[model samples]
Target: MSVLSVFVPVLAASPAAVLVQATEPPAATPVQAPSTKTDKATDETPVIVVTARKSSVTNKIDRRVYDVAARPDAAFSSANDVLARIPSVTVDPRGRIALRGNSQVKVLVDGVEARPGVLNNLQASDIDHIEVMTNPSAQFSSDGSGGIINLVLKKKRKDGLNGIWSVRGDDDGRYSANANVSYKTGRWTANASVGVNRELTVTRTDGRQHWQTTSGLETTTGAGRSTTSPRSSYESASIAYDLSPKDRLQLSGNHYRPRALSKDAGTVLITDLSGVLDDHAESTVNPDRGEGGEITAHYTHTGAIKDEHFDLDITYGSSQSQESSTHRLSHTVPSQADQAYTYLNNGRDSSLTIKGDYERPFGTSRLTAGFQAEQNGSDARSRSENIAAIVPGEADIDTAFSYSRQNLAGYVTWQTPLGRWVVMPGLRIEADTWDAGAVKRNDLRFLPSLNMNRDLSDTTKLVASYSHRTQRPDVFQLNPRRIYWSRLYAYEGNPNLVSQDTDSYEIGYEFADKGFSSNGSLYYRVNKNPQTDTRRVTADQVVIQTVVNADQSRAAGLELTAKGKLMKKLDYSLNLNLFDSEVAGMVGGETLRRQNVTYSGNAIIDYKPRPKDWIQLTLSGEGRGVALQGYKTGYYRLDMTYRHKLTAKWTASVRAFDLLNTSKQTDIFVTPEGDSRTVSRKERPAIMIGIARSFGNTGQ
Candidate 1:
């Protein structure tokens, strides 16, 4: 646990010659008061930081950190609220987070890859600090080709006891609550947390386009709305105890319960069609519920060597979901005779990973090596039932399958600094063997990286790096089973999909000062057998999407970012990234041409006109550059907040989104078939306000 920051609650940036990362040689911050409760304990925090590429003890880091402590009744809803506003980062609309605009990134929690094979679901309040490592060393995981983001959590203490609780309700009629606490005594510390959440989210898209069918006949477009909702509930609990200063054990589990409920109904009519109304209506109720859990334990020891350490960890996890569905006519409730159809599915999997690493520091250079032995297995069983409407007969089928994969890996990395130039180089090798009943497969990959950084001055710097990485297909992506998101859209996994390998080269420069900071980077990422499906497709029956691999593909982009204090009461931040992607074998033959996307970077300003009054205005927007030229659309949203301390312990707050009532465009999906057509769409605009108060003297 370490920190390097001094906050004054920004109205405008301050002209302070403070470093985002402090070097160890400098004087450290003064110690603060100790904890007065159990479960929470006091620990050492590194106040001095070493910045640079490989970062010498005298160099400074180029990233900034934000403090996001939890409050009562607070809920973290999305990645958008957590990663944004931090220095050197942005997460695009598709849950794609990146430094600049690279999706090949690594996300970690507490320094460990957070269930490497799962999705990102960390809450904001659960986060202590978001470490945005724009340029990492060889000691880091070399997977996709983007920077690393590590979300650190709060530590437990040994003493009395104190914890926080929160609850929230979303627009889709979802509610959730969470609580965490810890306790400690003399030589022991223990902590526990549990949470439950249920929410419904709906997405709709509308677009107009022109298309040519397989016969080469062209037609103009129509627009409509298709809605999709993921109504689900999740619950989890975890506990951990420290055996010693260097050893700890922890266990955790979670379950996801979702109402497999969705319906699609829309009308698509040509702008000039005479009595031509192409309409499609369908509803699917997937018996929605899922179960998942994990158990893991680890031990670590710091050696007598000045900077040597060793860690050993083992983990086991599994999850499954079952769905039952019967297609129904939209707006129709069968009376006399209705046949019921049930579809059942289940996903069961487990993993055991034994990983170890050793690190040592010498002079201005550091060296580290690690190894991992992992085994993953899954067992699945399923059944289907279909009954006729009238004199019905039950039709049933049962099936079973099993799969396993074993992986062995070893890596070595070196980091060093000479004068103001920093350098890091490392290599990793992995061997994997897969077994599925009568079939067996084996794959091997080697990853390498070389990075260099130079401090042009105390306020300016230049950086360049090159890497060769590999991405093995995810297990879910390789499954052949059909994944039903809704009746209109279905996903079929391809077990025979090939792995995608990539080599990335990047160069960038930055300028940092008390009043202003600007940074820009250019990168090119080339891939072999990239995994991306047709962005959009059309059909008369159902939108069927087959998960397939593409030939070689190329993605290149440039990002420009600027931020600083505009005045004593105003701050500004802006970031823009333009990227191009080319795919072969798409739409048959010729390389698919598409415009690059310019992702959004937001800016916010807070004004404390008086000691009891404050106001915050934020501006946010995103524009996707597509191949269809004018297919990109964007919006400017304004959110304002006013807060006042009515009394010493009482406060009130109000915030609004789209305050001006300006219409905003969210997304668009269009496809055309010569004989007939289908369309999917969605949009939104809203405003919100809330108030609260406190009776205790919480830390200010």
Candidate 2:
């Protein structure tokens, strides 16, 4: 076994003369500590720029590092806010993350998967750094067809006790408070963090749909307004002990609780050439609550064998959630009717994972091997009943389903260095077993990966990689149950769905000089059984939206990014990713294919007028592109922030999000039968002010 390489943390911005990267030349020798003796020249002239303004960017063999702790926006309360500031990363209106043009990404905290919404619970200030791995190696997990994102948390340093506390508030009635504390003694250290937040939000949506009927095309226009208030609390603690200089053990635990109260009201008008046929109004009240916790134990032993390393980790996690909603509908014209319904859902899941890895380095060559076994079990029950309605009611609307999944995987990788070129070859084998109620599936899969890097110059590198990956269907997706939102709309999962497989290849060039850095890559991917959301209209005029696996899909894209300083006092980062995708599949026994070209870009500019003041402006947008069953419109947003250090221990900041209020998301769906629907959603903008104070010194 061998240990992973230790790369210094660096920012991911383009190189700028005024903001140099923190990494040093591989051939550069290490410098010694300063001594008491001083030369006459040193005394006459002071070295002001000790290390190029403490660069926040670093480039790695397989990923780009972003030192969020070094950025002014790191103090944000949500991971969504922090990730939105990074180039090549996008956060959707629903808080989902997308890398490049793909959303099937895996997010980890300290090299392990945390609970859902964990990132939303995490305060940006607690993050030490983030690694964006576009192409992962064999040492990592085999999930996520898009990419991997790892968040490294801050640990305790030095001795004694030290901590930081912060409080924030916004005009929308959102407030948050956070505290982090660390204590270190000799060979033992403990770290803990807690955060609590309450958020209130309002949103509006309007859309029109045209349906092709036997007589003619009928139109329906609808408008909706929603208000939601959510409260969340998170806590994490860890303890580390060193048995020897080369042996260490650690235990960590995390817990998250979140609850939300929401209400939505909507009105719809249906008309045809004859005249307005019906006017309908609907209202819904929803309450959702969830709690999750994770416990992990890890042990690492280095130098157990000459040039060898060993690591072991085990984790257990569990979550429980429940949601209840009540809907009331009233209609005027075309036979007036009033209906009321109640929907209840309860879900619980648990996971266990055991992983062990070994690594050995021989001269310029390195070898790594790992084995992992994971088991996940979940139980879900949903029930719906009509309290008062004009439609017929069923007595057996309740349904319960249980799912269990097990995956056993092993992998081996070897890295060979020859002159200015390094080549890595890896193989992974996995056996997966899944059981969903009466349905069962088992599969044995083999995946291969290859990567090569060539040093073109002292400041440039050429890299290429290829890998085979799979995206398994989630538990919810494998359950065959109907979830109804209204009389006209319903959603359900497909029990016969299969996994999605992808073959990906990429070639890239990286260059860095002084403070400016840039990279570009071309990638092509082919997918089998690509899962996508689809829309269909039933004979009874009800629309059903569900996840379906497509026959085949292909995507080709180019990604370009640059970051660094524009001037001595100005810093900027930018990224552009463009792709063309095509999907061919059978819908309603008819083969259909659609092709689309899409792109997204992000630009950030920071200005420091004084040592104590920081101001930043960011613009981001995505171009219109194809959806699983239809297409989506393009959208953009603008945001700004200003921070001032009131004193050495105090800081104040203000931020404005979606200044233009144009960050709306729109999508249009068209079925093979000529049935079409359009949906548009927009969230209200927000302005926030925050204050923070820190005590003690943890060697920040």
Candidate 3:
């Protein structure tokens, strides 16, 4: 019995070394009436083996962990292709992820929290492996300002059936297909999945602006081009149950639809005079849809208060949404304008959350405490119509609007570990209530946080942090419609807004071990009472622009990420982020400053050569710089993927998204309309391939 007992033959067939007598098992010789063990509750809390937590201790510094079932040569199909490997994480222009450069984050898959919450629901070949906490502890839910990207999803740690089925095709015009199914027994476990897609896009632009108005002077110049064809679709389903080992249950459903058709014609000059119509007769078509479902129950408990360990969760949910728009505007000075808008949003957001966490192991130290509570709600119905001159002596006008809102929040967190230092402290308090039948809005806010880390050994690490953040105003942008005439451009809704505060500072450095890792950070942000608005013009009045607090802004950044294993079957990753922000300008009193720069990134390379055999190359990108007035117009892109592992439970993959076909623009140049307008962004082209087969511990 050597070589660790022949490399652990189940720890030498341990039942405590047979006879189940490793130590203290012979003292259970007393029995009284009523015994049959079925719901035998007597402070019972055994069975603590875990699958979702991902075992293995200690991963100093950049702290890395990835077992996509031992890699399988991981070629990445989604789950953001394994989050493009952390560090400054970005996938903006609406592709999600947006970390260090901030796209107003917060995305979680397993622990819930995912929606049209600004980011489109999912598809990355139906994910697995995407965890970029970027210094998140204190029991999470800090509402991602550029941190936190969970997305776990992939289970069944043992006892039977596993699944996956795929079909993919691409060259960027878009096409896709998918399916996944699962099962596990031994206290129960279950899963299900489905998918579909489509795509086409193109765009171009040029501009110049200078203006001074009060019934005064103006000069504007422009250039234009556009082509967009889109038809996108998706579907989702989920179920999970494990009633022991600390209770768990879940149910989920989702659906999304996108339809687009556009042919652009542009030319408008107020002073220099330049007009040409029928660039496609200014045609536009768009349609969006949404559906939701949720029910969850989770619980965790541990005792020996003198040594602390506790966890808990309980949640309930409901949802609905629909949107419609029809527009046709041809103004080469002909007088035929057509517009139709329909928005019906129903709501039921419910919450009764009570979370508590306590952890203690103080010697070489570790201490933590956490708390949270939330309740949310919303309701909507708005209808608008306009027809100004349709061939005859035409005249038509109609308007109807309705809105409602309510929200509540509470938060607390603390952590400590001295001697080689590690400390975190937090506090959050928010209460916002609103009603717009033309008025009723209340506000309350308080936020604070601090973090510090030190461990100059085991592969170096040192970090620091300070935070305070807040932002609220969304839901038809506080629906108080100022103007709505869309076939493209002319959307305004602002109900006198308030609430935008931010203060941040950070310093960092981290280096990891084993397969290799790299980290870097530098951050600064300052914002206060920043909502912004001021746009006025008369003669019939279109006096738009709302949401004010008079600007004050600043942001700075730099980030980098790296990966390893150049051989041993090749694996690579590279990530980068760069940002510069400033806004403060006024021409009257003479005080000006405006600066913008943003660049986001992604890179990947994988090769198996053997094992299960695989091949891969991926590159993803986003860019923005040069913007003003609703600031849009920013673009850059690249994508490609290929995978093959035909046996050991079949596997296949193929993908192409925006592959060097970059186009995005969102509209600006409003020094009160000296003119140069027509902006739009958020277009997707997809191609996906699939074929999957797996069973039992596909989780390895």
Candidate 4:
């Protein structure tokens, strides 16, 4: 990327001549400043005037980039907070993220795959920008059928030592601290960072179930309260050496440890047509611990020609986790013997990836090619034990399994200008093999993609694209062992599940001028063998949740976004999405079809009361979500933040989340055998305050 600087004279506003530079053009245009000069003859200064123009959103050929620093509240926010304000993206109060109504989205940091819980620990100040790729090219991975979101971390290139440190705490017993430092000398650069966080959450849940018994209608009601606390710590280091003016070698490594504990107290009542059949009080305790680490090496060589380079990257990662749960039930209504249940589970995973890419300019066009290979393995073991005084014939479970997968892929793409349009077409070929206990499978696929862009005017453009994507089942989804949540509830995976494939098409229009910009798009997608969850009840009244492949599915949507300055001191952004989806599949030996229309949107407003102080407010919500068996209710939330620059090196911020206390969620499930409903709510709103300090010419 290249930085452009422009100078223009305008009427004087503050009697100061300022030079403005565009970092990421063409979305961010230079702000012409006033240039004043006194006439030697009359000693009178001429007046010049100008206006400032900036935008946080940037539209690209295959993706959209959101500048994190452009947001007013980014100084003290988390990665999840930034994602909620992005167009076509949704984040729930529980920190679950979804893109375009799809939850199975891939997330990356600094062009590398991110580990679980990494995003939660990353602060907005550490990120330079975020990229959303709805329809990526053949050079990217095809793991996520929904799309991809990548976070680019900030890099310091100053010739001296630079560092930043910050600490934050919430009213709900949650706290975090982070520190980062970078040093550059001669041809060598080194960077190091450390972070630690403790999160506390409290929730309440209520559920009701209705079913038909041999005698008559039966009903079950339950209510529970739970509290969870998770503590995590991480450390990372990286070093890069310039072998020559055109060659570079870099190595990096990271390690993290996460631990959590949860406790729940609830009561259940079972009743038939006659009256209450059974009632019990239950208490459960769960503890979990995990550790993960990764190391990567990268080498890059720049050719003599412009836009020509060859790169190689190799990475290895490993993780291990263990969890245990204990539950005790005491009879209430009909005074019976008490029961105790204990469950233990352990899991381990390791993966290695190697990738290489080459790019060169071809006349007025460009050519790019890449190859990738990956190997992954996982192991899981679980045991369940039950001890009852009166309940007999209860069975215990012990199971262990191992799974492995290997994948190799190659892709090539060519970009050329045709008349008024720039067209890029690409192809990708992949071979995959998987082995899990008695299940073994092999797959070969060929994927194609095309993208075209035409300039209608200096400030307007049109774009069209098409791509084929695939998503394979993860290890958790492919395991065949059963895990019991309660005496009457269990979960199992499907080893026979196959990969899901999707064909996506999109057309869009973009317009930018002055200080405003707008982007609108229409997209359609068709899916084959989409994966979904299904529930079935056995003769023993146990509910089993498992995964299955749907016969067919389709989705169509329209997305609109606009960002501009409402006034000299105010800027705003608005986003809206409307879509309809339909799916048909077989569940519990019955064919079922589901369809619905949904809408989601978010709005952000920033106000600058003073040159060194600013405040921001955000509101986001979504409509009811459609599911294979039922639907999930919609909800909206309000967030506010205030920031003040104490000095050039110090900053202070305060933030509040869920101001309206409307983060509750409800899920309904209806089937031929029974109907169920569940509602969950957070205990209280969250408020946080933080302060940051920077040194050694670090840009804020």
Listed per model in order, the count of residue pairs whose N, CA or C atoms clash below 3 Å is 24, 20, 9, 5
Candidate with best lDDT: 4
Regions more than 4 Å wrong, model 2 = 1-22, 25-55, 214-216, 304-308, 335-337, 387-396, 698-700
343-391: candidate 1 lDDT, tens digit per residue: 5777677777777888888877878899888888887665655523211
Give the total clashing residue pairs for model 3: 9
- By lDDT rank, best first, the candidates go 4, 2, 1, 3
lDDT of 4 by residue, 467-538 (tens): 998989988999987777766677899999999999999999999876888999899988899998877776
Give the least accurate 10-residue stretch of model 1, judged by summed lDDT: 52-61
CA RMSD of all predictions = 8.3, 5.3, 23.4, 4.0
Rank ordering of all candidates by TM-score, starting from the highest: 4, 2, 1, 3
* Candidate number achieving the greatest TM-score relative to the actual structure: 4
Estimate, for each residue in 1-700, the C-alpha lDDT of model 3 and write its tens digit: 0001111112222344222211112234353333346653522323222112232112332223444434442323545545544445656544556666566567776544665421243544345455665545434554454456766655434467666555555565555455665667676656665655454555554444444555455544444555556554555555556555544555555555545554444443334233332222434344544454444444545445555656565555545555545555555444444333332223333334445566666564455555556455555554534434221222332444455545455555555676777866766666667665576778776677777778788776887777776666555666665443332233456666666676777777777766676767787877665555444333322334444444676778877767777888887777777778776745224344567887676777777787665666666665653332445455556666565677766777665566655645555645544444545443455666655666555521
lDDT of each: 0.55, 0.81, 0.53, 0.83
- List TM-scores for all candidates, in order: 0.75, 0.92, 0.29, 0.93
